[model samples]
Target: MRETPDTPSPRSRRAFLRDAAAAGLVTAVPGLAVSACSGAERTEAAAASPHPVTPAASSPAAGLTSNGYGRTAADYARTGLTPGTVQQWEDGFRTAAANDDPDVFEWWYSDFTGDDGTVVSFTLSTRLDDGFVPEPGEDRRRPRSAVIVTDPDGTSHGGTQEYDWSEFSAARDRCDVRLGPFTFTGDLKTYRMRGHSGDVGVDLTLTGLVPPFRPGTGVIYFGDTDDHFGWLCVVPSGTVTGSVTVNGKERSFTGHGYHDRNWGNRPFPYSVEHWRWGRGSVGPYSVIGADLHLREQYGSATVPVFLVDDTKAGKRLVGAYDTRTVTATESAPVPYDDPAYPRDYYSKVHWTYHDGADRADFTFTDTGQRIVSRHYLTSPTDAQQKALDRLGIDEIWYTRYATDNDLTLALATTHAAGSGTGTLEAAQFGLADAPPRTGSSAS
Candidate 1:
């Protein structure tokens, strides 16, 4: 298992910040908008097949936090929580001990896409060692935030903002979280969000089109220590109506939107190689899914779960054994090298899915790359870096891609086909940046 990226104690707090500042670690702003020569996006067709792991015979029971752990919805049901939002974003854990663990992390996430091909995403998140919980004796650790607003043309303006613990707050009763200049508030039915960094400012509102879908106790404990992590999909699919302003020009946009909550004890890469997740809208049908490949020791807990709103069956949640992911080919790999990197990484060309008898396909091509060498630069302290080094990791790659859909639903007596459009991505972690290379790494 990968090591947690956190500072264990507050004893050397001042020296920690000084070293981070010295290595340009504490700053969160992204670099200038120049295209950093991305690799190609086409070529060798990979044979298609379902993920190697077979489906599980049984699934965990779904319910409220009776055992102090929230569960995923076994089937679609209206969430009884207040409309605006659940306390998951702020108070996601079942125990005060987990909440106070600096190793734990939480973030409110949403992605907005304009009809004109502009994509904007913002996340207000932080590791919990310091004072994330505001209480008489709580630790007062600040949080870090990141925002990226990229247009179809590749023009972008956005970066990260590190906030002092005093500037972060989340309502105990609703989905109101303030991280310095960024604020996200509203019930799950509707939410207003605002954030400004560098030369970019994003002001958008998400209105629900589909009711919230919570999987059976969303939390999962995969390690020997049983540290748990969970996700809540407040707005599985929604409508985005707002504007993204870059420089002084503002562009209004309208499209489908997605908002969700992610909180856990370890970064995903620690256990998962990567995950393919996306939400698409076609008429009244809202489609979404998540396929995961667990890395090494964490393979035992891998599962695939997807939610689809069908006019005939309403909305139902399905498990991995109930679904299949087949890759017809892989696009050119967006090259990077870190001499100490581990694992063999490759691009996914056109990925197809079959949910039991229903089916859909999406084709994605590399559009842009976000190179945040921050993770590899130095993780807060020499000790943290050394720990990461033992894991054979350094840099991470998040390459954005546009998606085209081809689908054949089994809803009818016979499989029926349809088409749609959206976005998808590929993530590479714990690898060193290599000299520019492209194409498949196949022999």
Candidate 2:
């Protein structure tokens, strides 16, 4: 397992900010700072994956405060929280070159073992850029596709599927996915994903890459914030592949197990194409979940889309939420790095929507989260370049929840009555646990 990122006692950010500013790398805005280069030369491709591991530079400890989180705008690009505006520009760039908008840009794969050692796994990703940028050459759109699998370690594996239309089709929820002869079901209750790599099959680890910084480029953000959602939890499966017997049947799968949770609190209004998700326990009973939201510019509006895994039955549109009860909380610097930073750490949250006949009372807890700080500089004209300035996003998240439910959640950053007062927004809603699995495996 990789070493966990540091969750300092709120003071470390100041120190990091001071060092960045002292190096003559200050952002014009007081609310955020630019990440300075350490004079280390890096490949252009690798530059996008900044700050691989700065958490180790801090002091080690037992447990961190439960409510600890961040609101850093610079960390956006480094983490994978694609703001709609940034994606809009990137889509424009792709349009000018590829001539075809990609159906899926990002994905997630997760494997978990339930308490009984029943290996369970899932994957999810986006399809067709209905709301994404189109290629300069191609005037038509294609369907976005995604897939997921479970019991990867069982005699018969299980999973789900998804597809999206760019033109005029409702987003298809849980569709069935075929793995060789056996078929897996899809649902909104699970996360799903798909991607290409000349390589055969890839491991769906529950971690994402953080981009490195470039002066004027922009930061990267990851996790489920503002407008996306993907969270999967694992309880007790062990590592190792191959078939295993469960309920008198043998099975086969590809990965190991770790107790965990996966969920998001992203805002809507931003256009997103694809995503992948997985969850693991950062602490006992407490889970740590992560998601990747791929954004591409559409037209006038930024559409935020998501992909989920339905591990139980033939999937359909899962219950989702578009809530209005969001609330924000502001905080101050604790005292670690830079003192000039004056922005309050904002955590905008709303209740999860529950689907029921009588009362619509629903909820999901964001058990824990950590910040991935990033800094960059960029011009506002180029989508990739423009992504740098407005690209800075605060991705505060939770990995574990109280129950297993299907829901569409969101998080967002809103301007406070004016043009540029940055306010962080985060929210989640529980949709439904979904009906139980039915019928036998499909072929």
Candidate 3:
């Protein structure tokens, strides 16, 4: 099954591209700063004429530590660094993360690289299940679940499944959820994912190396509207012990694991056109970071969110603001062998991070990156579905870069600097407008 969005509400342009993004991995030609698709950006507004949905004023419970969080919706409500921004998780998958927010979206993501050049990643999010609003007759959910595994040989394959609302289940109080053949069960300390993909499958367990990283109320508000992004690095740092199989041949991988969740309602392209996200284990220290933009309402920073963690100095929540900064200097444009994907915004990025007097710089060279697998998502509303259906070709190219980098991490006085392997994703979501395809036509 293809991964698609739960809402059918079309934004602008063709609804299919937005809908497609909701489901899974898509590759198309696009660029940053330029419109990635023929889509329109919507100005979000709250229903003052509103529903009785909980307000964003709630905060995590006092003294409730991040590691103590569980699958319960309330556990999440009490997450983040700020109080009142959190909300309770309810039965069904959506409530556990998105609750009653419209344009609702969320995901459970994990990834790890084996010592033998093998790379594996997984995402189980709002696309995997449905229902942020409580309704017995609401079955607007489309393609519900997703699983992708890139094999050691660079071949990528996985599965996306949609279930009847009656078939999907989300534990009312914990992180126990099942949408089709994908199952995720976890407490604060550890989590396990078991996925099925035809003849291939992945069963992995991840144990946290640090507590969950909650920034602010985990909500980043965009402009005056309710269009916002919620991010929580649940497993900011962790160790992996699992087995992956391809056509019945299986091998266990012992390496570092990273998991996080992100949710939003508005079409992503409308927010910011492009972004670079990455997480990797460099020896004993785990690293996770991202640099992205979300227009003006996101404070004074040129880059709304620029974060990096060595995983040893706890987590840099909202407290890390002002002091922490990242400057990404694009070295060069990445070339795509796939002519259909003409955009090459992917670059060799050099990032310099600063926290007060401490400084750490790392360059993420675009090397050893390739096409492993792909997935899809669609618009939710019937009207949007029809809109998407008319778009013909799907969304743009979303590429992943696994780089070899030398990072220097300084905390207070001590510094850890070394060369290690890391993974970064360069995705042109066409988050705004549609740019002309730049490469050669496919033969």
Candidate 4:
């Protein structure tokens, strides 16, 4: 059994902010600090799988305050809350939060997989900070965008760019955002996105096939503090018709796509230890799953959220938030190249959701196609690097994998089983101390 680390006392918010500023952790754009490096390519081989351990069932501890964290079905029933409803304004720009504090951050994300095996993903983000100390006529709240395109032949092309704030604008009443030459606009039913990075450009239209979904109130509060994280799947499953231009050559195609929005008031390292998020379309069902592990200060809780939409029947089969009903097991550990912590990370994960007679199982296995791998703290100054060491923030690694998915669903008298391709992401903010490495490791 994996041992749970001891819970640490909560850090003062003011002190955290001080350290963050000292380390130059704040930036004009979110997710751009990473140092991009590709992992070694390897083929899959059969290995012995570890025994799965079931998570202990626990009721909400006293004084726990949250909308969707560590709550059971009965708890939600008392609050008269069902799955979730789409609010037009929820998909709009989070102007209030973005302007409230420098620590708050927001971003829009979308991706499409063509029928011919090409994949395109992109993000538009608001600033995470005004500036370390602004100079005259300097606006650090500039908007930024990134794009990644992987052709069917396995060639990848993409990059990131930051734009002046004057070139950025967003509507508060709907899903309309413009950053330089990039534009992402949509209602609940349909969306249009366009962006360019380096030699690649994408213009796509996505029509929704699954209704929008939120686990509960769409927000997870940390204890009694005002700090929280929010997420909404605007386009769970959609059809995409678009053209991708690469190296002065343009090609049009039809494909499937997914989009979602995320916003939070606190730095992710301070709240989240790690998470596994993924979505897929199998047979007649569209499924999305996330397993979030909170930091020790937040009771080290594991929150599992899942949604299964029956597109053929035009109804949702399950919208689960309770950790007791939804569970995840990680296996098939593989060592990655982290000198500070020579530990193995899981390359295979299985998720299961069951309530009474209804049950669903989804498994994702990495096929060795690592599209992204980077260290979050890129090119820190000498003083900033020292501050990071003081805070025990060693290596923050983010990796994305192209995966093969196997899904089985049995709801009442309906049954479905299928396999497909999808995307899975793993992020590590911190790790326990490990012995010094005597040799190199492979991913």
Candidate 5:
């Protein structure tokens, strides 16, 4: 499923290309500036509008500490944030009003060689997942495009290419990236990169590729199409392929396997979902897990999950965990024309995860982020508007300081429980921060 915003949306050609150029490693854009209002009340206006419908018989509540938030839909409307798409379902997969706010999801990994933060390489993947269920019966082709921009003063460089299956399992992805200062290369099948931070300047490389399976996979993803009760699965397995480069050195990788965030529910007290790090002789594992509980001002509880993986085992294990910090870097006041909110904006978050063998620490400082504030009409009675809310950061900046980095990882389902019951494996080592993938399915 693909979604293209026909209503002239904001697009930054330079930001897109700069992100692509930092394919092989970490690319840090300037942190986005946002409004820091004192005594800022959490209102529906501050968040995406809710969908309208006969309220669910009961709403699941997520139990977590309040960040001193006290406001409802009414109070928020008083603020500038306008309500757009809102839909409340009487009986739906997940309760609450479905808000169709424009959102962008970007993941970045910066791998350092032997502590001391020396020599870095990173890969940044960005996507826009505007919320809307294809207008019920509307199967219109969603317009999508990725543009690469160069920093003329900084000497930007990167590559562009797509892959086609040469044989059933034998796949080949083509990419052309500029390696060093003012150098452009084309059709480079295999390459590797290594470099210092300031000495290197990177840009974007656009592709004409269609998203597989889920739409809005980039931004706010809901339950999976196959199983309405569970969370959405974006990169299921062996579907995404790209290479990373930094400074003058680079590396070519299959980026095999898949990883996803599950937004499932749990009981009270255990309200926050979590993902942590673990190790085994088989492969380094990161758990994409979370804790679910009830919130102070909600009917039921909500489950917020994240993706966690480490290369101690053969496959970087992933599961959910508790403890998350979503810092809204670019919180603009409501009303699109508001001068308080900046246009080229984004968000950043800090989270922690643990699993016996290792403790995972992640500080995601994502820049160049934006979300669509719109309304959703699930049904005639279910009309609602989701206000502009902060989305995921462009970069998943993280650090895995383990008790035993040599423990190796073993794959388990990204949302599975128990031990010795996983199938994924990690193939890259030394660069343990990079997410590992496998051919097996972990649902």
Candidate 6:
């Protein structure tokens, strides 16, 4: 994930640090830019590539036209976007929003699940709250780091820390990022991470087993030219070997790990309503899936992304964003702490993907162990709470859970079914006024 021949010139380090001090937020870097090519241009680019990626399967003859999002294959065909292609510089930091836009944010996140049932996860971010848009001159973008460690006994330990902007620096050419005492640096194939917050600490190395991946250009547009979100799975599934320290006690572990990067300039409450994202390995497959629901103004589209790799065959079975090839369903309402908000979130989700003669079905059920539950408004004033309520932002919650997974696959040459364990995340930002729940708990 470092600089390649395609990398643009990076911003001056001195200027970045100086402006960071004055503004207290990590704005866009000089070389960070988004490609807003026209449909014709994108088509031309696709035609030029030696490997022209396309949807895994043709549209179903008589079923859902779009993926979870209301986008049909024709829509993607018009935009010339698919669920493949990984630009060399896509894994680096993307802070390309206007300097004065408090909505701009970026983060690198990783999690490891040990063979002995322990889980360790951490994140280094420019901002901790996705729903809080700061006022002009407000200093709220200090570099933030958070860690969570879950022991085999189901106990979780970790905390969040914020540091001055002076302590933050990241390379535009690759994935070299430092915040305070923590560091995360790596190439797309391998990574080294070391950090600590509160009583938990981790020093780990991750070796990639699958190549880096992104859906199409890895950028999801929101009906506007400049409004979009970017995502890249630098390490879809990897081998993690490292040491974790808790309460001054250290233990060594070998396990599986996953890492992904996210960056956007649009406020969460105004853009995304909720999303279900998870990743794991089952049988001979390593899989990642997500269901993203946009807000009403953006046509309330449901965008689905799913990827499946056949480790045994050493090839990809499915990498798709079309409804005919990928779809998802969820049930079992998981009510929020605030009673006034609707139970729009779910505790269970099922994803299905079909490509040619290969197919995969994955179901993730929450084990009822909540490792982290964060409320954006930790301490809100009366007036501020009122304003948020008027905007229908009942409560913004971010929750991570330990999950059990059941998977079945039917490929051209193999058929298998198995069960495993993994991690799942639920993010609710603007679901206060969402429609009434319809699905029963029985799926």
- Per-model lDDT: 0.51, 0.25, 0.51, 0.66, 0.23, 0.65
Worst lDDT run of 10 residues, candidate 4, spans 50-59
Model 6: which residue pairs collide?
Answer: 1-187, 1-188, 2-174, 3-173, 28-95, 66-323, 67-323, 68-302, 69-302, 69-303
* lDDT (Cα, tens digit) per residue for candidate 5, span 1-443: 32235411122322333344456322222231122322111111112222221111011121111221212232122111122211111011121112121121222222222112122223322212112221222121121112222232323343322222121010111111222222212121112222223434332221211111111111111221110122223222221233334455544333223322222111111111112222211123333322232223332233334344333322333333223331111121122232422222212222345555444443332222221122223231221111111111111111221221112222334332222211111111111222223322212
C-alpha TM-scores of all predictions:
0.64, 0.26, 0.66, 0.76, 0.26, 0.75
What C-alpha lDDT, on a 0 to 100 scale, does residue 439 get in candidate 3?
Answer: 35
lDDT of 4 by residue, 70-96 (tens): 234322222222223355566777544
In angstroms, the error of model 5 at 435 is 32
Steric collisions counted per model? 29, 91, 49, 0, 122, 10
195: Cα error in model 4, Å: 3.9
- Stretches of model 3 off by over 4 angstroms after superposition: 1-102, 128-140, 195-197, 295-324, 372-395, 431-443
Could you tell me the lDDT of residue 308 within candidate 4? Answer: 80
Clashes of 5: 122
How are the candidates ranked when ordered by TM-score, highest leading?
4, 6, 3, 1, 5, 2
The residue-by-residue lDDT of candidate 1 on 1-443, one tens digit each, is 22325741232433444465566654322221222211111111222121111111121122212212233332111122222223333322222234454556677788887778787887777553211121112232347777888778977678777777688777544577888888888665788889776788888999866556544445554533234456677777677898888887887878767788777655554555545555565545566655555556754343454555542333432222222343333445644344444343443444455645656554444334432323323333554455446555565445444555444455334345566665555454444322235444433
Q: Arrange candidates by lDDT, highest first: which order?
A: 4, 6, 1, 3, 2, 5
lDDT of 3 by residue, 333-407 (tens): 545566665454545666676767777676676575654423223334554444334433244335676677767
Candidate 6 matches the true fold with a TM-score of 0.75
lDDT of 4 at 165: 69
